[model samples]
Target: MHAERLYPILLLLGSNIFMTFAWYGHLKYKSSPLMIAIAVSWGIALFEYCLQVPANRLGSAVYSAPQLKGMQEVITLLVFAGFSAWYLGEPLKWNHWAGFGLIVVAAWLIFLD
Candidate 1:
């Protein structure tokens, strides 16, 4: 695809990476104070929003709001799945994979005219 379409995808990917860390990275640091974790997560989330907002804005030129949101959800799940397994040491069960597959199908349906 053209840069117009590709750029937003890249931005969203980057944003989701940051978001996954922000949301779940602290699980490994349970010994840290809750206040400290919250503060750090908020800082990381600020960067996520920075990228996410621009991604949606640029993507809006080529995609509808619902389409953008659908894409974001898919990206989030994919990123979280990997992050959960690799970084969080959480193994996804068969049912989790099936649920994720269903969500992927739902995302595909959102693109249908």
Candidate 2:
């Protein structure tokens, strides 16, 4: 694939990394105040949007809205899985894989012409 198509995927990957951290990194600090967690998550989410907005805009040129959404959902799960295991030390189980596999199939269906 050309750079134009590839760029969005890269941006999405980067965005998902930040997105995962923003949404769930707070879990590691449960003893902290909820207000502080929300504030910190908001800060991190700002960076996520920085990449996400551009990714969607650039990807729109090459992919449909549903395709972009599908891609983002799949990317989000993949990033979350890694972040969950590595950062939180919580490994995924068979059920998670089964569900995620179905999502991959759904994405494949979305991509069909």
Candidate 3:
């Protein structure tokens, strides 16, 4: 694929890494004050948005909105699966894989002409 296509995927992947941490990394710090957790998450989310906005804008030049969203969903699932298992100590059950597979199928359909 061309750089135009690959660049957005790379940006989206980086953004999702930040997003997953912002959204769920706090589970490890549950003992912290709610305000503190929220503040840190917001700080991290700022970085996520910084990348996410540009990714969508650049990706839009080549991909439809639906395609971008489908890509984001798939990336999110893949990132979250790793994050949950490694950081959160949560093992994915069989059903989780099955559900993710179904979503992958949906993403494949979205990319089909």
Best model number under lDDT: 3
Q: What's the TM-score of every candidate structure?
A: 0.97, 0.98, 0.97
Collision pairs in model 2:
none
Candidate 3 residue-wise lDDT, 25-93, digit = tens: 999988999999999999999999999999999999999999999999999999999999999999799
For 11-111, candidate 2 gives per-residue lDDT tens digits of 99999999899899999999999999999999999999999999999999999999999999899989999999999999899999899999989988999
- Residue 83 lDDT (model 3): 97
Best by TM-score: 2
Clash numbers, per candidate: 0, 0, 0
How far does residue 50 in candidate 1 sit from its true spot (Å)? 1.3
Alpha-carbon local distance difference test for all models? 0.96, 0.95, 0.97
- What lDDT tens digits, residue by residue, belong to model 1 across residues 1-113? 99999999999999999999999999999999999999999999999999999999999999999899889999999999999999999989999999999998999899999
What is the descending TM-score order? Answer: 2, 3, 1
